[model samples]
Target: MAIIKLSAIERRRLSAFITCLVVAILAWVFTALSNPYKFTVKQIISFKNAPQKRAFHPLQSDTVNTIVQGSGWQMLFSRMNDDKKVIEVDLHTLENRNYVVLSSQLKQINFKKQINNEIIAVNPDTLFFDFSSRRVKKVPVKLITLLKYQKQFAQSAPVSIKPAFVTISGPAEILSKIDSWETDSVVLNGLNESYNARVKLRPSTEGNLEVLPKSVMVNIPVDEFTEKTLEIPVKLINNHNYYDVKIFPQKVKVTFTTSLTKYPDTNEDVFEAVADLDKWKLGGYSVLPVKLTHIPSYSKIVKVEPRNIDFIVKK
Candidate 1:
């Protein structure tokens, strides 16, 4: 090619193009350096198989730091591709150093892939945890029974529970604080006879707790009872006008049912039956006075059989 010199205008144009290209390259490098790529670390902690009596708080001392570095574009693309990238961790990796603290820290720290898409690896490999002391406690239990019976039937006494206590075990902080426990109340309204039932234990207070022997067997002592009969005095209201007529069977018989322990002795005349004749008229009429013959201090009547009676009078 023959030697051709560039005109002034052509030289100026070439210079401007070179400067633009250099500026573009410099901008790209600066941008890349400003923002770097990042990755996520995921890990799972393990513990020995043991009965979980109560909920536990994990230890935090042995967490392994996980660090990931990449180009900004690479990190962004990784996060977008797969948010849930699984990271495998070996339990054996956690050797020594407060296991409780490590375990606690592992639990507290939640790791997941960045929303953008990224590759992540959990550092230190294993999670740490602590095995602490636990104990079982014997707690006093109270039983209650709820019963429903026919209208004529009534519950005679308070329901009784057998072996009124149970054993409970859990974390020391939880077990030590609990003083006592109770069961649901037993219903005894309109109960004619005795009954047997099973009740469950309920915690009297709230906290981290575990109850052993969740249920208890309750023995309710109930029996059909009979009441003694007593004869009561009769008062005839119309008897004054019918002086010529005589009344027969002037006394009334009253009977009720009660417990054997509450039965009155033969020598004790604690009950009486009476008849009321306050509104009796004279002409071949019979009148009787009403009276309450039987009364006990400590016992309750199950049923008052034939509570009332009549008397006959003549004019």
Candidate 2:
């Protein structure tokens, strides 16, 4: 083996030659990418301008291969990009015909994009459909929520949604299976006050179904909760044999949490504590259990002073 060492001047010359070679390669690459080229990419197909008189379902796939004529740079960048392109087909022709030609409507579709990247062709040049009777129906809009509230705070009133009902139109058979449409999930954390906003509804999975007024307004009422204690008289029930029953404690302390807005107006009249005599007769229990038969909505029962009562029965 022979080791060849070069002088300082020779080393500098070699470095310059390598630098020039790299620059020349980069320039050629850039020029090639700048030239026009044609390529094909997969795109999702959507529809617009649906025929009002006809209900149709597509017989083909929702995706198609789109051939585009553009700069080589576009092809190189498009391959690296993760975003998908969508092509929309007009269905107005379906009123008189059963199929649509994608090539014929490229001009109309491209007009909406207002771009110079021309679409050369589509793999599935034609789209077919299955027809059915169209039906219109009105269904309730259900609000979906995933909410978290601050400590001692809760919903004080029923949640409200404007235009509770939405109109849906689609194939008669499909519409018959749907009773209600649900909105996108409403998510909130540490909710402590009233919330009001507009939410979009979940889109239909069926391509032939259409939902009107795609969004709805929502209102949720929230309030702070406070504790309340009331002395409610215990009533005896299920004493079918006319037994004279005397419970040691005639009244029990009911401690509960209610919204601040209803605190002032809330009273023991809204609560009913009863001792079921059937508990002893049916289960042969030694002690009678006291239960709250009636409690206001949106109120939480914290503690009942005497959950079990001692009674004397005489026949």
Candidate 3:
């Protein structure tokens, strides 16, 4: 090539352009030496639904050292503003997956920019939770009544807990209310003779509920006291027709106590007094019967103080 020479101004212009290129190259080298990009891995703790899009907060608050690889200019641009490349996460995904690992290369990151409080209150404060196996339980029934009989006596009727069953329904949490139920006890110790009384059926524990067949009729068994004195006629047994045997006492006095309700309208003829002469000859004798001489009419023998009496026979 032929030798070509340039003017002074051209030479100075060329020198200036070379100087600028060298400065640019040195600047590029310097940027490459300095770290401008960063890569980080963080743990996702929890997530919340937001009405509006917002950033996330990291679990750690301290700055973490991370390695980033990029062009000098690109790395420098990232360092200027570290927030643009942060990953966005959804609440549903977090809740479903339960855990997530976020790996990213950035200039710098902040934990505060990753989190925001723009959450919406889609769920109510009180939730109505339902259980699939919820079931109904039956409660028992109780009965209460009063009973009266003839004057001077009172008692409780054979009270029967009818249908003895109850039913209750509610949430599983509330079903425990049916553990126990009871009826009131009847008091009839003070009644005299016979009486007719009324009874009330009420819940042992007052509550906002009802019992089936709330009322019942009761028939109390009772007795009345009645005093009676009866004269029993004595009859001789096993006496031969030829031998005329006579009882010294023609009549025997007997007294008895019984319930008037049971003894009402009973006749005195129901009682009898008898004498045994199987071992005696035709003669006059006095003997007391060892057994009861009479049976009370329509009444049970509670006691007999003197069962026998002296008997004298004459032939």
Q: Per-residue alpha-carbon lDDT of model 3 for 1-315, expressed as tens digits?
A: 898798999999999999999999998788675643433322222223511221222333222232334445544554676453322333333323332333321111233332221111111111111222334566664544454443544332243444456554434444566674444556555556433344345642311133444544444445556666666677777676446655556676666666665466555577766766654554443464634555643355444334554544454
> 77-143 in candidate 1: lDDT tens per residue?
6556645433322233223332333333432233433443333444544444443456778878776
Backbone atom clashes (below 3 Å) for every candidate: 45, 0, 19
Best by TM-score: 2
lDDT of model 2 at position 92? 86
Order of models, best TM-score first: 2, 1, 3
Model 1 lDDT at residue 68: 57
Stronger candidate by lDDT (1 vs 2): 2
Q: Residue 187 deviation, candidate 2, in Å? A: 1.4
Model 1, runs deviating above 4 Å: 1-132, 145-152, 184-190, 203-208, 223-257, 260-315
> What local distance difference test score does each model get?
0.53, 0.91, 0.46
Candidate 3 segments exceeding 4 Å error: 1-188, 193-220, 238-243, 261-264, 278-286, 297-315
